[model samples]
Target chain A: MLEIINPSMVSLIQSIIIILSGLVILIASIGILTFDKDMPNIVYVRIHVLGMIDVAGIVVFLALGQYMFAVMYLVLAPFLAHAMANAYFYGEDDYNTLYADDMVEDKYAALNAPDKLDDDAVEDESGEDADSAEGNADETASENLDSGDESND
Target chain B: MEILLISEYFLLVALVIFLISSMRVISYKSVAMGLIGTSSLTLAVTIILVVAGTVLGLGFFKDIALALLLLGVVGTIGFAMVLRRQD
Candidate 1:
């Protein structure tokens, strides 16, 4: 099997693989740069495709006897994936904030219906009257305590 | 070998692509987009350096490329956190 492999042919094949992978990565980088800022899903998909091309390049490097490059590429692959995923998932908070005003109005409209407000208003008024009566009783109790102190003095 | 020479040229092409894209970083209006651009540029440069290392037989360049890739990921996450905090 080893004798059947032509060294020059292997070299050419490896070179082609490396070049193709590099081109893929380069094109993907350009794609990423030009991607729509608003479409995070597309950006994320492109990044994943770029990562696959990077892995292919690393494999080519390994075939060309570049062990260090292969190892480094292997180690960095997960970090890149993690970073891209984090940016895709957690980065949407800014976008949510951008549309928060619209959401707030919709939420308020849903929560505060006319019938609900009428019922809450009546309940609130009754509760306020009761709270005032309780407050008056507490004040009288305090006044009685003060009078008792004055009497003792 | 002629194949090696071609591989080196391809690496150079990739490097040029990375540099060209990186130049557009300032044109992005949104912080997240800018961060994404910066990280992509960093990743491209790292890939170019790894290709160069294989071509030139420089072991250290591969290690440096790995370190840069890790740093790029960390920096991208930090930028994401900053953007979240701003919101």
Candidate 2:
């Protein structure tokens, strides 16, 4: 059977496989970047699925090239997938915290109040404890007002 | 020669994806997406190198390609772990 297959023809077939797999990787990258916002778990799974396609393409290309070390890559691919999945799911809480911080910053900026600057500083120092920062800001603002009244009198 | 040309085209496609993925600036999602694009780009490059090696009758390039594939996998997993820990 090996003798029957023309070497040039085999080379051509391998080249085609490589090209096709490269295209798959390209398409999957696009999908991963442009995917619409949806369920977190679903999105996470979809990205990993695309990643698997990429790994499949790499394995195919390496195997067609007759590289024996392809097995090492194949073995490591799953662990990479698992790591990405864990980053997505297990890190949800951190994402939520980041989102909340962004909201507070936006709100604080829009108010355009000078006293909020102190609160912003406090928030930065304490890291994500906005309520306490707000209380401190209120106290400082009142203190400033009282001092202003005394100086004016 | 024909294989080399086709592989070059594959490299071009992968480069385009890498550029697009790099331009993403939103969030950790972008980081993950960039990692995928980078790995794909590495794979495409490896394919080109392998074809070149075959044409030149050199066995060394194939070993380099295999090494690159291993690095791509390891780098991706490391980035994912860092993202997970930082988050």
Candidate 3:
């Protein structure tokens, strides 16, 4: 036989837990917001780790029905906070963008010799001219349709 | 019945506020302002839970659930501290 627990006792425990979850999420939000972009990659990883914790807190609170709705909010709060930090502070393409461009150049160099690359550029220039001709034909067709409409009117 | 309906209405409002605040927190350039917005959202959610708890009786699920929520809060604070120190 299993021992029975009092329902009131459970409520008290749940309330306490809910309050704790809220405080943690608040701290995480503050941490992520205050984190400077100049910090090392290790810092970003740590922030993400905390974000994962926040997610866990939300899921647990969601399960508790006493303040289930309340728990849901606690869970969502960190996700929102962390997500914002990611988009605003961490999203700047400054260093990464330059690095990405360098990577692209390296790849392009690897794929073709410098002379061959110049040949490809000339080919593209010709291709663009062809495309412009095609575009002109499309514009002419649209103009003809407009003229037909004017004639009907 | 009226209490339940009222709670539901308030819950909806709170949910909308939560969404708006979240968006503002993310988009705002000021880190401090974003934190304030997030705190406001936390408060709103807490109110929501209290209102919902009043409507729905406390039970076993509630206790376990609240404990988990507390853990999340703890985790958030830990991560925040880690991040703050990194900065």
- Least lDDT summed over 10 consecutive residues: which range in candidate 3 chain A? A84-93
RMSD of 3: 16.5
Question: What does the lDDT read for residue B9 in candidate 3?
Answer: 49
Worst 10 residues of 1 chain A by lDDT: A138-147
True contacts kept of 2: 0.44
C-alpha lDDT of all candidate models, in order: 0.66, 0.62, 0.49
In order, what is each prediction's RMSD in angstroms? 13.4, 15.4, 16.5
List, for all models, the DockQ compared with the true complex.
Answer: 0.26, 0.23, 0.04
Per-residue lDDT value at A45 in model 3: 45
Winner on lDDT between 2 and 3 is: 2
Which stretches in model 1 have alpha-carbon errors above 4 Å? Answer: A33-53, A60-64, A67-85, A88-153, B85-87
Ranking by TM-score: 1, 2, 3
Could you tell me which residue pairs clash in candidate 2?
none
Docking class of 1: acceptable
Q: Better model by TM-score, 2 or 3?
A: 2
1 against 3, candidate with superior TM-score:
1
Q: What is the TM-score of chain A alone in each candidate?
A: 0.48, 0.49, 0.43
**Across residues B1-87, which tens digit of lDDT does each residue of candidate 1 receive?**
488668867766876775676567535664544665676677667767766776687889877887887787677777666655543
Better of 1 and 2 by lDDT: 1
Q: Give the TM-score of chain B in candidate 3.
A: 0.50
Model 2 vs truth, CA RMSD: 15.4
